[model samples]
Target: MKATVYEGPRSVAVKEVPDARIERPTDVLVRITTTNICGSDLHMYEGRTDFEEGRIFGHENMGEVVAVGDGVDRVRVGDLVCLPFNISCGFCRNCEKGLTAFCLTTPDNPKMAGAAYGFADMGPYDGGQAELLRVPYGDHNCLVLPEEARERQSDYVMLSDIFPTGWHATQLACVQPGDTVVIYGAGPVGLMAALSATLKSASKIMVVDRHPDRLALAEEIGAIPIDDSKVSPVDQVNEQTDGLGADRGCECVGYQAHDPQGHEHPNLTLNNLVQSVKFTGTIGVVGVFIPQDPGSPDKLYKEGEIAFDYGLLWFKGQTIGNGQANIKAYNRQLCGLIQAGKAKPSWIVSHELPLDKAPEGYQHFDARDNGWTKVLMHPDGGSHN
Candidate 1:
């Protein structure tokens, strides 16, 4: 098999790797068709985490199941599936309660918090960026896509991570009908939050970001654009929401947030999100924040210890809900929306390259190049190839 391997900071290569197979009773082997280069991967690409060299690095995956272990039941050979970024045992205590992200079954190594196909801090499983992947607990993790979806692999592939993650942000923020929702960061994930916000009947949807292209995508989804590069997002959102602030806010920027000067401004988005919403509003923070940053790993605990105005939050009586998205909880409904032609999240994809081009895709996405919003990669072989 051929796959992209992360060699070091800003270094990756397309090379031959071992094949994937059903290694456990609950496992399924997926012949990957399309996978995506996600923002989360940048944490490792930029050398901002304790990621090891030569590790596979893609998680947003969609493929066809070619084989399944004897214990697997929900899917069989030839099922076109969209694998959730999270790898969880369906019968775990957390899994039974819809908290798949915190699945107690850590990988055999026990150093990783949980297991994901190809992600930092998410265990030893190889990513689907390869020609094939060994999907653990495939029957529980793979969302079987409809036949019509096979034609739009790029769009449906977003289900693997950001699309569902952004939707998760909105849902966590308690976005309700007729509420004014403000989202910080108009990245692909932020744009999806804007898109999902519209679906919820928000009275006004405003997306903040310096990138005009991202804001343009937000506009296409009926969101008011806030160009933070030109003026303060706080000023714009304050004015747009009549000074009371938006009814709810979503923080999609996470710790990788950058200031105009290009330095990592970790708490800027959260501070803005806290200030952008109403007095009693809530914040849905789906963007990832590493508890320990490798760039300045000395800050370790400080990496997650964002210095924001909690006093203001207390005074305003606001609430916050933050963490990873339990993707399995929402993939089905989101897929149904896609199947009905009601949502086309694929509009966020800016590039679609062959799997061999993943190294280049990582470079473009890492540089945050304008108009380079999202990239989808298709491996060589199997169904949909």
Candidate 2:
């Protein structure tokens, strides 16, 4: 098998690796067809995280099941399935409560409650950025796709992560049908939040970001794009809401939030969300915030502490929700929307390349290069495309 392996800071290589096979009775072997290079993957790619070299690098995955373990009763060989980024044991307490992202039984370390494929500090599970993926808890982790998924891999592939994560942001923010919502960042997850807000009938959707390409995509989806590079995002959001601020807010940039000058400020988006959301409004954060950043120049960020405006947050009486999205919690409903032709997340995809081109895709995406909104890799060398 061949996989995209993390080489070092801003580097990756696609090369032959040991084949992934069923290691347990509950495991399922998938012939990976479509996998995405997610924004979060950049954390490892940029050496911001302690991701080990030689580890595969993908989580957004969907493909055909080539083999299934005896214990897998629901998923079968030949079934097309989408594997959620989270590697959870469905019978765990957290998973039973639909908090699969924080499943207590998956992580190798007892202190860590959640696990993800190919993610640093998550678990030992290999990712599906290759020709084969060994899925644990097959019946529980695999979301069997409809027959049409074979042709709509790009859209369905999103079910593995971003789409559900975006929807989870809306849920955390408690976005009401007529509520006005503002989201920070215009990356894939942010755009998905905007899309989720739209589907939930948000009266007004405002997305704050500096990237012209990303902001343009938000505008195309009927969201009012607030170019923070040109003006104060808080002011724009306030002005659009007639000085009341948005009814709900979402933070999608996480610890990598920074200014136009390229100076990283981990607290930037949190403070912005506090100011842009109205008093008493709620905010949902789906961005990836690590516990530590040893390479950070900022003292507070080095310790994974942000000097957030907690005083103002409390004064405003705003409710804040932050965590990883439990992909299993929303994938089914989101998948239904896709199957019904109501959602098309594939609109965000800007690059489709074969598995061998993964390093190029990572380079362009990690640079945040213009026009690279999302990159989807076909492990079968464009056969799925």
Candidate 3:
């Protein structure tokens, strides 16, 4: 099997590794047909997140089930499926309560939110970036796709992560119908958040970013695009809102956000969000933040004390929702929307590359290349595009 293995800071390559096979009675083996290199994966590539070497590096996956173990009944061989990025045991304490991301069955680790595929500090489960992936607790993890999933692979593939994540951001932000919403970061996730905001019928959707390309896409979605490069994003939002700010805001940049000049500034986005949001508004933080940075020391992130404007947040009576998206909680509904032809998250994807080109894909994505919104990788070196 070939996979994109993380070597070190700013290093990744596609190489042959052992083929994935069923490992437990509840396991299933899936041939990797579609997988994505997400913004989250950038953490490991930049060495900002600690993960062991030789580990596979992809989690947003969709594929056909090639094999299944004895205990698997819900999914079988030849069935198309999209598994959640989080590897929850269904019966775990947290999973039973609908918190799959913090499943209690997660293997012990000093560093990790819980078990995850292809995520550093998340778990030991290998990712599906290769030709095949062995899924533990297959019956619980795999979401059998509709009949058209094969035809709409690219859109369904997004259901594995970003789409659901964007929906989660909207859900966390408490986006109400007729409400005004603002989101920071026009990256793929942020853009999807803006698109998802449309689904909730938010009256006004505003996205802040310095990139013309990203902001242009925001405008195409009928959302207000605020180019922070020209002026403070808060100022633009306030000017548009008549100083009332938005009813809800989303933080999609996480810790990797940069100022207008492209220098890293972890708190800049959130601070802008705080000022651009109404006094009682909620903010969803979906951007990844970490204690270490291979890029350099960012003032917002200390060993543990990330420089956050909690003082202002507290003063403003703002509610904050933070953490990873529990992908299972939302993938199904989002899938139905895609099936209905209402949402086309695939629009964010800029390239479809064969497995062999993963090295180049990683480089371009790492640099956030122009028009490189998303890159979908397939094991066989081809795709729907």
Candidate 4:
């Protein structure tokens, strides 16, 4: 099998690797059809994380189950399924409470509660960015897609990560119908958050980013685009909200956030959100923040720490919810919306290439190239116009 292997900083290669097969009684062998290169994947691609060489590099995946272990009863061969980024065992205490992202059973490190395929420090599971993927705890992890899944593979595939994650951001921010919401970052996740907020009937949605293409996507979906590169985002939000600030805010640009001049600031979005959201309003942060960044030039970020305006956060009495998204918590409902033609997250997809072209996709996306908002790879020679 050919898989995209991480070679080093800002590099990847498609090389022949040993076939991925069922390794346990609870495992399912999936013939991957569609997989995504995520923003979080860029963290590893840029060598910001401790992701080792020779590891596969995809987490958002969907495919047809080609084989299943005897223990897998619900999933069957030929069933189209989307695998959640989080690898969870259904019987864990956290799984019972719908906190599957923090499942206790998948990670080898007892101190780490969650596990993800092909992610650094997550677990030993390989990702689905190849012809085959070995899915652990098959029945629990595979999300069976509806019959029309093949026709909507691009949209359905998003249920694996960004769609649910964006919805999670809205959930964390406590976005209510008719509430005004402001989102920082117009990347895929930020655009999805705007879509989620729109579906939830938010009276006003504002998205901030420097990229004109990304901000245009947000505006396409009824969100007001704030070009932070041209104006202070906080001032724009305050101006739009009549100086009361937005009722809710979301931080989608994790630690890799930067100014228009390309200087990295791990705490930029957090501090900005604190000022943009009204007092007593809620904020949700779904951006990936690392525990350590040995490659960081900033001393505090080297220790995986950020210095944001916590004093003002406390004084404003604003509440914040932060963590990786519990994808399983919202995937089903989001999937339903897709099946019903109510939501089409595939609108954010900018490129679809064959598996061999993954390295190019990674290069363009890592550079944040114009028109490269999202990239989906098809291992079986699939293509979308």
Task: Tell me the TM-score of each prediction against the true structure.
Answer: 0.96, 0.99, 0.97, 0.99
* lDDT, each prediction: 0.85, 0.94, 0.85, 0.94
The parts of candidate 4 lying over 4 Å away from their true place are: none
What lDDT tens digits, residue by residue, belong to model 4 across residues 1-385?
Answer: 9999999999999999999998899999999999999999999999999899999989999999999998999999999999999999989999999999999999999999999999999998898889999999999999999989888889999999999999999999999999999999999899999999999999999999999999999999999999988999999999999999999999999998998788889999999999999999999999999899988877899999989899999999999999999899999999999999999999999999999999899999998899999999999997633
Q: Over the stretch 242-312, how does candidate 2's per-residue lDDT look in tens digits?
A: 99999999999999998988999999999999999999999999999989999887799899998999999
Model 1, range 52-170, lDDT digits (tens) per residue? 88888789998888999999878989998998898898888888998888777855565544578777767888988899999888788989999877888977888888888989999
Error of 4 at 310 (Å): 0.9
The residue ranges of model 2 lying beyond 4 angstroms of the native Cα positions read 383-385
Model 3, backbone clash pairs (residues 3+ apart or across chains), number: 3
Write one digit per residue (lDDT tens) for candidate 3, span 88-159: 888977898888988768656745446889887777889878999988889998999988888778899998
Residue 83 of model 2, lDDT score? 94
lDDT of 3: 0.85
List of clashing residue pairs for candidate 3: 254-287, 300-307, 354-381
Better of 3 and 4 by lDDT: 4
